[model samples]
Target: MHARIADRGRLRKVSTRLVHEHQVIAVDALTVSDMVKNHRLARAISDASWRERRGMLKNILAAGPAES
Candidate 1:
């Protein structure tokens, strides 16, 4: 859904959608930065946008939209 938009916007949209649509999203609790320090996985990790995605997930789960 983010072919044309920036990564930041893409992450936001995905997280928002998942939070609203799904009741049970499983996010890993690993430390992305530390794990990405591995040379073998650095490129793959960077391309996946894991850090930003994780942050978005945590934010939405912790404090999602207000109830009507």
Candidate 2:
């Protein structure tokens, strides 16, 4: 239950980031956000809370690429 809640919060955070960063984003739903955010949040939390921050970031950095 706690993990589910944290995942939900992470998804919301990612959706906001996407919309705020990409003005033309059309966030129809959060299913997309779930996958994307999971990868990101996992990476961020791992880095911040673990000693392998750089390794975690390098591994997950390509999870989201900037649009051209």
Candidate 3:
């Protein structure tokens, strides 16, 4: 009975870690999508005679610090 309880505790910890990891992965995917969308939008605007669009993108990109 004691061994079973210990196993349950370990399983719970593992499950928690797995859930957190999945959340992080989801957030990362969202960030990547946002970045790609931003780039495309910026490029489209730049192509459409908006010279300031690239500068806007640079400014926006500067806000997102590199993640470890």
Candidate 4:
């Protein structure tokens, strides 16, 4: 639980900095659901938290004023 919380905090910080530093952000379109269906890769993919990072980026971008 503590680790998850820390990870989330770090992700938020990093995402905010990334959005503020760049005028545009681009990410590959990934089929996460399908990729997760593969048992061998599921754990690794989930641990990476790609969806959470993307969501954070979107929320930060939507919240206005990226400039510091």
Clashes of each: 0, 0, 0, 0
lDDT for predicted candidate 2 compared with the true structure: 0.46
Decreasing lDDT order of the candidates: 4, 1, 2, 3
Best by TM-score: 4
What RMSD does model 4 have?
A: 2.0
lDDT of each: 0.79, 0.46, 0.42, 0.90
Colliding pairs, model 1: none
Please list the residue runs of candidate 4 whose C-alpha ends up more than 4 Å from where it truly belongs after superposition: 66-68
What is candidate 3's lDDT per residue for 19-48, written digit by digit as tens?
445533221113333444676576654344
Ranking by TM-score: 4, 1, 2, 3
Off by over 4 Å in 2: 26-68
Instruction: Using lDDT as the measure, name the better of candidate 2 and candidate 3.
Output: 2
lDDT tens digits, residue span 1-68, model 2: 99856765565455545544764643232343344467757665543332232233333343555521
lDDT of 4 by residue, 1-68 (tens): 99999999999999999988899899788988999999998999988899899999988888877442
Residue 3 lDDT in candidate 2: 82
RMSD versus native structure for model 1:
4.0
Cα displacement (Å) at residue 26, model 2: 4.2
Between candidates 1 and 2, the one scoring higher on TM-score is 1
